[model samples]
Target: MAAPSRNTCGTRERSILDRVPPLLTDLYQFTMAYAYWRAGRHQDSAVFELFFRENPFCGSFSLFAGLNDCLTFLRSFHFTDEDVVFLRSVLPPATDPAFFQFLRGLDCSGVTLHSVPEGTVVFAREPLMEVAGPLAVVQLLETSLLCLVNYASLVCSNAARFRLACGPRRKLLEMGLRRAQGPDGGLTASRYSYIGGFDLTSNVQAGLLFGVPVAGTMAHSYVTSFTSLEEVWPRTLVTVNQDHDPVDLISLTKGWLGRVCELLGAEPGKIHEGELAAFLSYAIAYPQNFLPVIDSYSVTCSGLLNFCAVALALCELGYRPMGVRLDSGDLCKQSVDVRGVLRLCSEHFSISAFDSLIIVGTNNISEQTMVELNTKENEIDVFGVGTHLVTCTKQPSLGCVYKLVEARGRPRMKISEDPEKSTVPGRKAVYRLVDADGHPFLDLLCLALESPPEAGRPLSCHPLGGGSTSLSVTPAQVICLRQEMFTKGQVTQPLSSAAETKAQVQDSLQSLHPRHKRLQEPDSYTVALSETLHTLVTDLRRASTNKSNVVLAN
Candidate 1:
């Protein structure tokens, strides 16, 4: 595929370029590119793999996201004239102008990308993506790829944890726009939150740009607009019968309001005028979907009773009230109390639909809050999570690193004092092994040149570092996790829609064993190397140690 010509760059390309300039990369990337150009090794074939060392949010798996954005960046990868001019002005005087020319002509056309499809469940040390191309070109992609993947994966994992805590039936909404790091961060959170199983978002721009479903309820300001019942309904009579049975109170109030309004020559069926006016106005706007925030003043005294009256009045007008939102107070106790009120109204008013009214809780909810709420008896049907879902408060970052694993068709590895920091060497393939019941038992990494794992064949799986322990398994199914995302610098696969990607996440999570999905001290999923790959890793570690020892002696 030919590089996108500067003159022919369209609106979409320009949008991508605006978001990710060629100079968006770290300065070291350009310096290394220049060094490669000076040494005439810029075109050397190299392979780099992107992976994380540990799961974020203390969870066993992460939901892969942002591959679409990474692909977009790669497809439009090239330095503009402005970028070239900036580079010339900033580099050392000893640097060559030809290096700028090389950068100006650079594109990812020579690169081949292999990646696990976005929304797949990824674990530590498994290659999430691989880039193969000319050395300098692939090197230039490191920082941007990491930037896109790390935060996206982190947010998605956090959202997934929220989803797990809420269970399958409850609604999860992402309301992190105001609390996100920035505008772009807010948009990213909305996108990945949907991919991680959130049902909706409260960001309008995110909904417009990324097609995430947008939803919201009235704010406290809406509730505070009216000063008194008379202002809401002039000449309308209102009464509260405290002595009536709690179950029969809503019916009696409805009757009293009707009789007073009739005697006063006013709106006969208009409910309690002040707070109910706000709800009535909102109902006029969204008749079929009327969910009003009720806790602006009080839950039991003002909010719940007022909402019940307005909701029942709307039901009489042939509109089904969606629910009420509890934004403050003891959410667990308040939601149950609010539900009891709705139940009483449903019984008295003969509105069966009132029983299905959703109680939405949006008071600084977090994953821990969800877990705790799950243990308590509460009636919260929907949860709107903001800061914690988007910011990943438990563990803010997913430590994904992109490293060169092969150069000139020879395997390379980075050895570190901390073994966990060491890079796995070579061009590799990842296969998910499934057992008889179709649950993934383990992920097996092997040399790309080796034969793929065959189902029903017994194989020895060894963990890295020559450990004595090994897992013997005969897989019922073999699934190759990575697909060619970009071949010869052009996209090889169609980008998946957000909905499709979300479905992928849901399916992958369902296939995983429940134990691995646990939020606390979850069972670890096995990620092992094939026997041949383990042997290769062992040899490479020994060679690296020996070389270090020799260097010390010298």
Candidate 2:
């Protein structure tokens, strides 16, 4: 294989892929390659398919992702002199030096990849990607490709599920950096989360590197940093106009503070001056976007009061504060209470914009919590989700496997005692059948040489494989799902940007039947085989079972 061709992307994003050096794969991959070399089978042509057996998070579907990273990794794969030296010291002394020389010249030039488009909704048992190349190189690609696709696809699917749990209208923010595995894990989560329908992220590096929208607010420390208005000195604030003279904003804030205390029936002396000063400082810094965490001291007792006073003051100065965030307590109850306060202020002051101010729920929110929030009434406009969003706590890992399905132009199968573990042999074509309503009805697997089903034509297919039941229907639409993406050391397809892929996710979801995409008890999406494929696999399995003297049920 030739080093992945660098002609597909710009230098910046290309650098992300370049970091995936050839040594990134698992140790067993190289060991297998070495064994193949000793048998003079290293250069034999082979085909490997990457697919999962079930959906992650107990959901009915997954979104294809990390195609960009996979391409990048393949494009830049090469054993450097240093990598060879490391391998020499690690391998047994009986290892031939010529093997190291063979590795030095390995690259992805001969490899070709065909994959489902990134962000497209995919189901279990179907190939998300296919890689074909010389036996040794393609075998070595197994672990690394799975490593990139498994978690990338899992986190992306998890984020999408969170979006579904919250509905389409609510904003979803990814704040998983602190809870992510590491810097790269955070970066991966941030990038894929955006593509999975998140509106923004708190990771500045992700914003810089992947173009994810970045947003955040002052923390509890920012509020606790001040104790008196004196520390918030020169409390003058200027309008957006650079030439406008600074106004005595601190005085205005105090006046509003008194008004808020009276309107909310609170003691004027009860409001903490230090918290007020902190709010004042933050408001001055980001008047147009002064969202503050309100649960530090007291959401109702002091924090909310301080926020309202400073917010009203900023509004008086021709700037509207964005909103507030709740990080603790009964989130739904607090959200309701906070909304009541903001709505009362909006009506009292005739500040109609305040009626729509964002209320962010920053609890340790998960998909389950979001669902729970819907049953109880609340006014949370956004959810800044952490931990579970990136880590996929409900399901830690997606089980995607890469298997050699063909070698030297011959189809192969891994016959297993457990039928679930058996491999579907050979290169095949996949077609998605759409109903008259534009919803996908079934996915058909056919031998690569078979003619595809055309619209309005009746088709017969086995249910999965070797099943008695067969599907009988005429498809309104027939779409080829997998196509060549990378080949001849260059990307054959024009890769979409993350934003574009995100749009595709929404569109893909819309194309599925509602029942198939529901959160719980989702109707399983149908995947079946064409007559030719069904017969081929059934006979192959039967012959293998007979050879082992095992009687199989019909």
- Which prediction has the highest lDDT against the true structure? 2
- lDDT, candidate 2, 1-554, per-residue tens: 12213442364366576556678778888888999998999999999999998887777898889898888788778888999999998888888899999999999999999988888899988888989999999998888888889988999999988988899888999999999998878888998999898999999877666667899988889889998988986689987664678988899988998898889998777678888888888888778889999888788988888888888888877887899999999999999999999999999988787887899998899999989998898999999999989999999889999987889998888888777788888888889999999999898888788999999999998766446677787899999998998897888877676677888888998898989878888988888888888888888888886877754442
Q: What digit string (tens of lDDT, one per residue) describes model 1 on residues 1-554?
A: 12223433343345445777777879998899899999999999999999999977777888888898889899888888988898888888899878888888999999999999999998989999999999999999999999889998889888888999999989998999999999878888998998898999999866655567889978888778875544433322122232332232234335544533343344433333567566655655565788989877656555666666666665655567799898887888989877876786677657898999999999899899899998999999999999888888889889999999999999999988888888889999999999999999899999999999999999998865447578888999999999999977789898666677888899999999989999999988889998888888889989988988999999
Off by over 4 Å in 2: 1-15, 242-244, 549-554
TM-score of each: 0.90, 0.95
> In model 1, which runs have C-alpha deviations exceeding 4 angstroms?
1-17, 229-274, 465-468
Clashing pairs in 2: 1-107, 1-108, 1-109, 2-107, 2-108, 2-109, 4-75, 227-274
CA lDDT of each candidate?
0.82, 0.86
Q: Which 10 residues in a row give candidate 1 its minimum summed lDDT?
A: 233-242
